[model samples]
Target: MVAGEKIETREERIPLWKLKLDPTNVRFSHLPGPLSDKELEDEIWKENETRDLMKSIQAAKGLIEPPFVMEGDGYYIIKEGNRRVVALRKLKEAVDNGEIDDFPASYFDKIPCEIIPKKIDPIRMDIMLAVWHVSGKKEWDALNKASHIFKMHRDKGLTYDIIAEYIGVSKSTIKRALLAYEECQRFLKKYPNDPVGIKRFTYFDEFFKKSYLVQKATVDRSFRDKFMEWLAAGKFRTHRDVRVLPDILEDTDATKELEKGTIEDALNTLYRKYPDRGDPLWETIASAVEVLRSMPRSEVKAILEDQAKRHLFSNLVSEVDTLKAELNRIRNGRSSKLK
Candidate 1:
């Protein structure tokens, strides 16, 4: 039960035909029009692990966990486990056609379900779904999660605070998801026929989270469009490449390399221009400093009390001192050359 809303639920076995797929399901929200049951099943089949789930269910002979649903007049609307339902339906088809004969048709005919009353408040229902998929177990992929958050805030007109409170996430997380979702939508509008572009939600999400990149894109529409074009062109090898975009954008040579060559080429150009930034030793030292700064006081006390830990700490200090001396010597050598 979610706070402030009293939900009435009952367990029952529902016929497969009587269970309706939710068109507003976050997984298929990108589709434009009303979808038939077959269409919903087709869409659900495209989800990750659907085939694996079908095999798992075949071995188990039934669902391991019942799907959650809402009671309708003559049917029940599935709120969770659409993929599982699709798997069952497909398995049933196989059985009807005699594809595999391990299980009978009866196993797939009636599915166990946890049915919530349709009379429940719509907002509460949305909140409950958000809690389950957004922050709870049975989590949706990043794209679906962001799309759900976007709909709740934009279509349902729910405030960020309300969503964050209900979904057990920070308000900033909700806002970031909404921003990334909107950007992805804009990308889709530009390339409506490009189905593969929707899968790059993580690239857009990571891009929006970087303040430097966001500021640049916010102030310059051309830069944003160029980034979109790069995304659509599949220039970024992975989403991690998006993390170094700020550095690439800051360097003229690196940006040119990125436009013409690969992300690796652009990174090489950036590293060449700022050699110090690419130094592994400097990075290690910086990471060490960060770890030390963030270490808990309890751990620090334990280290002080333990001889082995204190010895290790002393060695680390000695290494830092040696590094500092070497850095000063190099600096002084460079100063002498300038003189």
Candidate 2:
């Protein structure tokens, strides 16, 4: 035959012994035989498809050069073309058992192939192959696939590392992106109509844990839709606009002081003296009150005295439970006299 010329009239039947499995070929053949009846594979077994597969095996008059060969002997090992080998084995067994005496001889033909034996590490193949697949993908594409896997893992309530390993990315990246996603979710929920894009999300884990606003923003549709719409409008030009409030909001003491009008009243006085003490002073007074609350009650009097000496006459440092009780007593006495 001329070089590169196709061979005309090749023999249809390949001697079962001469055919060999090739690892270099990536193509797989349809297995004709009944697949190994493992319990695990029962889901794939459809009785209705059996007749179709059988008909294909019988009616396929054209010669097919299979990519790999099945080893006839000891402990079945498929080197390559696992599907084809399985199919051929099934057909041969059925034919020999007189299940179908008359069938196409060409079904077992020598499929033109170059055999390269596969050397697999049985113990680590699944893990290693999974890793290779993950690593080989593009970063953005990997992120997409990772996101899906991460969602599945989360649905199953698994960790980021397990999902990362399953999808083949570093656990740290998964964690970071997840944090970003969660934070973005919070911001999006808070200002759903707000035009704060994902680029502006700042993940603050502690803040999220404490903020009812943050949780509400993430879950409440009224808040979330407005924030997203506003964000989409390009209202927040920088990440600062999307910045998370400080963690002091979660402080039990700070919350109580706010309720008691200490922090808010002090801030109003500060605003009367210096007009720019809006958010900054609110934060300061809240933090200072939190610090005071964090302290022991035994030390509160001394702390209050020291702070008073420093001219820090915020409502928080000045008010005492004793003084509040005394005022209540005075009010009650006045009401009795009026009666």
Candidate 3:
């Protein structure tokens, strides 16, 4: 229900041969070239939870909810429930090939479908799919969601706010999806026919979360290329490693290490060059100093007037002095070694 659009629909039992799998299904949109019905079925089968849906259908012996389809020239294109259709097709295939025949072949002959008008506005179709998958009960995976959002914004010329309102997400969420999707497109363009760019899209999504990293990559083309190369090479072992990219890029030696090594090597170089950046004790001491510097004068006076508080303060000062003496001795030893 996109605002004022009224869609006319009817229910019917459509034969499996008359139902065409949509090649432009959001789940497999990243795939290159036109896919045949069998190819589409195979691709949909590869999606997460498709196997589970097949199991559920096998247990139930029929679909719980009918698939929604739009009438095409001589066929009906599956809109919603692509996975369910794929599942049914697979089950039928299993039975047809004599692989396993528990149920009758008549079960997969004709499927119940909610048929919509073929001439329904394409935008309405997009909105309906978004409602069913993006913000609805049967949600698409993150990469699939991003692909749909990117299509709405980039191809359809919809605003972020408009898409957010329809998808039940914030404008910022839409923006992040766009960024991640665009990065994935960039990767795809550089390495055509490689599904890894879309498969490992969360790595790019994590990379775009840090504003500093995004800005750096935007301003420096070489950095951007190297980062994409690292992404393709699987240099980032996990998405969490993408979070440390800003620190790695900030240090010259660490950045060079990352160019030739893994994120672990870059992080080790960064920490070794800047020990205080990685030291928990240094952070604790710095936090303590900031707290004391910002302490209220009245609180400090009260502490001085109370005997118990004064004793605690004296102990704190003694501990600080001891730490300072230890640090000074280490610095002196290092200086002596240098001399």
Evaluate all candidate structures by whole-model CA lDDT and list the values in order: 0.86, 0.44, 0.85
Q: Which lDDT tens digits does candidate 2 get at residues 126-204? A: 2232343345431223333334333444544656665565555677666655654565656655655543333334323
Model 1 per-residue lDDT tens digits across residues 1-339: 774877878899999988888877888777766888889888889866999999999888799999999877898889888888889888999998999888865768898999988788777888888999989998998999998888788888999988888899999888889888888888889987764767778888899889999898878878778988898776788888899898888899998998898878988888877765678976776787789999999989988799999999999889979989999999999999999
- Scanning candidate 2 in windows of ten residues, the lowest lDDT window is 23-32
TM-score of 1: 0.78
TM-score of the candidate numbered 2? 0.26
Best by lDDT: 1
Q: Against the true structure, what is each candidate's TM-score?
A: 0.78, 0.26, 0.75
Q: Report the C-alpha lDDT of model 3 over 31-65, residue by residue, as the tens digit.
A: 77688988988887897688899999999978999
The parts of candidate 3 lying over 4 Å away from their true place are 96-102, 193-195, 218-222, 232-234, 271-339
Score candidate 3 by lDDT.
Answer: 0.85
What local lDDT score does residue 41 receive in model 2, on the 0 to 100 scale?
Answer: 25
- Using TM-score, rank the candidates from best to worst: 1, 3, 2
Q: What ranges in model 1 sit over 4 Å off?
A: 193-195, 219-222, 273-339
Which residue pairs overlap in candidate 1's backbone?
Answer: none
For model 3 the local lDDT of residue 217 reads 77
Residue 197's lDDT in candidate 3: 56
Arrange candidates by lDDT, descending: 1, 3, 2
